[model samples]
Target: MAKLLLVTSLNKSPSLLLLSRTPSAPKLCPRRRCSSRADPEYLCRSIVPTMHYQKSLPRLPVPKLEDSMRRYLNAQKPLLDEEQYKKTELLSRSFEKGIGKELHEELLAQDQRNKHTSYISGPWFDMYLCAREPVVLNFNPYMSFNPDPKPEYNDQLTRATNMIVSAMRFMKTICAGYLEPEVFHLNPAKSDTLAFKRFIRWVPSSLSWYGAYMMNAYPLDMSQYFRLFNSTRLPKPNRDELVTDDKAKHLLVLRNGNFYIFDVLDRDGNIVKAAEIQAHLKYILSDNTPTPEFPIGYLTSEERNTWAVLRQKLLDNGNSEVLKKVDSAVFCLCLDDFPIKDNNHLSHVMLHGSGLNRWYDKSFSIIMANDGTSAINFEHSWGDGVAILRLQNEVYKDSTENPAISPKDMPASVDSSKAVTRLQFQLNNVLKEGITKAKDHFDASVKTLTIDSMEFKLGGKGILKKYKISPDAIAQLSFQVGFLRQYGQTVATYESCSTAAFKHGRTETIRPASVYTKKLSEALVREPSKYSPDELCMMIKECSMYHGKLTKEAAMGQGFDRHLFALRCIAASAGRSLPDFFEDQSYARINHIILSTSTLSSPAIKLGGFAPVVHDGYGVGYQVQDDWIGCNVSAYEVRDVGQFLECVHKSLEDIFTVLEGKPVKG
Candidate 1:
């Protein structure tokens, strides 16, 4: 019965980027603390302090109505037939000249009223908070860290200790305003050097952004960085809210379906000694408690409203103080008792876990399997990948470079038994039933999902560069051809491009399926023999060039999706009837995204992915490296993920062959 409810919820859900470029890591300060503010070390070992340009960052621009509508029509072209296209085009024109103009004005007025944040920030937050589905697959995503270079450091006890210590250092660095500012260096040799930094540091905070811009570098908005610590998303009846308690000093640990809390920060807000943290973690790892019959953590995987009701019951039953502790902890570190067997197993474990050992509501959780493999599964409402990726890179570099715990290190002599307290919940019969039901539903839902990965070593970014093709563009083209070969049709696809270049920016959609890609895919899949290698290569180049344009536009906040969405939101809020454009079938079809994809390529990350947005769609997380292209894909039972991956491999090979001036293999 619980399974049926989960499936029903799944069915009802609106089963609703880029080349792999690693963002530059902030420079770490020297080990010694400087007494004088004028010291070079006190300047973050760079000219500009972290967040130096945040105050001067430009606001995200709302594109013009006609421009957005034009792009929308172009994106809709390849997906619709003659009649359907005509109707949508007419509806779009009517909306643009009439209600859309009014809505745009209203949106501008609202944007003016909210000068502190982006126009889309409020609506975007509401979108995620108002979601009623469980966050497990619907909202939360995971990115796995690469194994440590030192094998011994991968030990669960040692790794968790080092990560926790490094995390504390990162927090301290940010708090002291000494961390290096996040930047995108277009010409690293010129702009990412000490000389450039020394010159830029003298620029006042109000004008620091222009100084960086003048150097052909862009400073990203780091407003979301504050939410990276001491935060959790609280589930309410119809909407959830994010809450943070920076004063909380303890760390939350989940093991064997049990919850434990211990202070990792001192009363003066200093990081506790590493040895003491190791002792506490070692004690937790060595415990032999059996899994709870009704692991309360599973309740976090239930439907949002359901979880809200169950949480209120807990508060009514003398668990309010304990719940507050769980909510206010700096962050969660989940210790899984089982070892992952492979990459697929790692994806499964990290993305959702066994459903018994995860608290899905925390802002972010560092999960360590028994084998010491670790990843971060984060709640999506409070932030995006920019903050999370920066944190992961810094943590990985620090822990690997300056590990505090070694294999021979002994646990501190302190009595961890007295320091760590296992949270005791007085679960009444109703709460117990809720846990059991949640567990059953979560298990059933996950059972229907599939995760598969593929690595193409045949060629990657280096080889594509030789052909003057964009690596990310070629990757998206492969998906188009692969889907065509599998289903004999083109579908709406989404590629995420960050607008972090602007203050309070989120993301804009890059519609990857365009007329150029359609031509390329059809030619490759249907008439490979009709075109010469040169002709096919030309088509490939066209797709790459056009995709690059789309990427730039989306990154600059010129994409049509968000603008249209904001206008629709304005009309809805004003209680005005939606324009004809909103009611068009093409809008619905284009939004039923079938191929939802993103790329985050970094040396510190091994793999990252999320569940498909729709029941029948595929979630593609890929990284295009210098010598290989790796993809981790997920889907529900309705699709053949394995077969789809096979098609993608073949598509890549055929494209590479054409690039090599050879005919497609039969």
Candidate 2:
């Protein structure tokens, strides 16, 4: 077998890496540019097993592959080590009692179909953006006066409508999610109750509209997978910088209070943008439909009238009014505006798909078109990209037909979910403290910080020109899969299917979600007590696995409360609603899977070049051929079409390593 060698261009700074495959590094730049080849250095050369330790505790035995295989496949050992039972024995097992036939049926059905599947719903976060919407505005508060469906629009509609019903069926086949549409805009007097339910289906399952309405929030569908919005303008910089070049001016309609600024960075290293400054600017909206009664009550006079005006204003002037209303509206930001020049504040809004918790608030990205003719990689929370593109085509196609279907006549419902279970298991070493104390935990930015000078190895030039992550991530990911291939006939490793959540095979654990949950598991897997920590770790793992698996499939199985598992643990632990606990606990499990070398003591892969920031937030890595990627998507994990080139770089570099797997243990 060949050892798959991989490399990346993302870490292009000196001490980090250069863009070369022949081992010759890129031309070194004297001045450090934050986004340039490598400024902050964290390239350590030594290979240490792990950095985990407690003040003065002895090293606990790391489980062997043999032991792990037994625990994963045969279920040989009880999840909880004996010592765990002795320690937290006083905790109630109320969840066990509540978990009845209903719960069992749900899990069983899900397992039968999506046993080897994993799920992920991306959002607009940092790095690559996962675009999705929480809900659709069936009643475009801002209906355009010129609603003409060009031939292309009709064609898209035709293609999308044809696939929808079948797509729903596909969802069932995988037992990933259900297509349930709830109504929030209907009035008993005249609103079509049945009609509205159908309308909601147009929304991508990523939004979990039912969940959103229940909680009173709206998530942004950044995926634009359907290409629903017209790209009036594409950000183009004469140069290849986000700032120096021009991007589309996204006019938003966030109420002054709906958003909280999470980060504001400038090239010159200053947090120049502020919410207060942003407040001076108007948040624009495409549709300004006024909900006579929304958020569980009638809108105040000011709010109602403001929305009416908002919709009207957008239809009349698009974002022109927004620019007028908000003084901080941008014109042309320059590349010099970052690290050394200016700062841009990325106002972090609650991604309706991830719910109100910040932990699940991942970033979003868009795929660029090679020629700016069509969108290639976009997934919205409200609708799928292909579906949206189809819708666009359908509208155009229908325009040319003898008789055309009206946009209002289309089915509004879409399957927007996957077999995502918030597994009921625990990590190997987490404690209650880790779950409850988020502030004290490691911060992503801090974690991303490098330790020392970035290492620009003066190595062979052939190895320096370009880099790829596909092989690197695959090198690690494939090993995991190959192991499962041997023992995972019944269950697939979490990484098996990257496109959808319902895929199944022999998996080490659930995917998409696993990449992130596992990271969370690591944080929680701690030894806080004098008793044997192993016992607690094992118990937590089992419970988490069972519950997580259950959550992902509730949608596919009828009458299955998605929270069936959460409710169970509530009972098993002799407690109340588990959701209440998550909010109270603040332990978010969403995987912000970023692509980079994991924080293992040193990143000296026996045979490798560089790691790219493939997946963001979750910090997991991924490798792919340039032309292949994205099965399921989120608001924060998308890249413009051009980003795919990196995938090509990755594949070319790691082809050999992929065939070889990893170095055989001594």
Give all candidates' CA lDDT scores: 0.80, 0.21
- What candidate 2 gets wrong by more than 4 Å, as runs, is 1-96, 99-227, 230-380, 383-576, 579-618, 624-665
Worst 10 residues of 2 by lDDT: 136-145
TM-score of 1: 0.93
- Model 1 score (lDDT): 0.80
Candidate 2 accuracy as TM-score: 0.25
Off by over 4 Å in 1: 1-47
In candidate 2 the C-alpha lDDT for residue 465 amounts to: 21
347-379 per-residue lDDT for model 1 (tens digits): 999989898889999988999998889998888
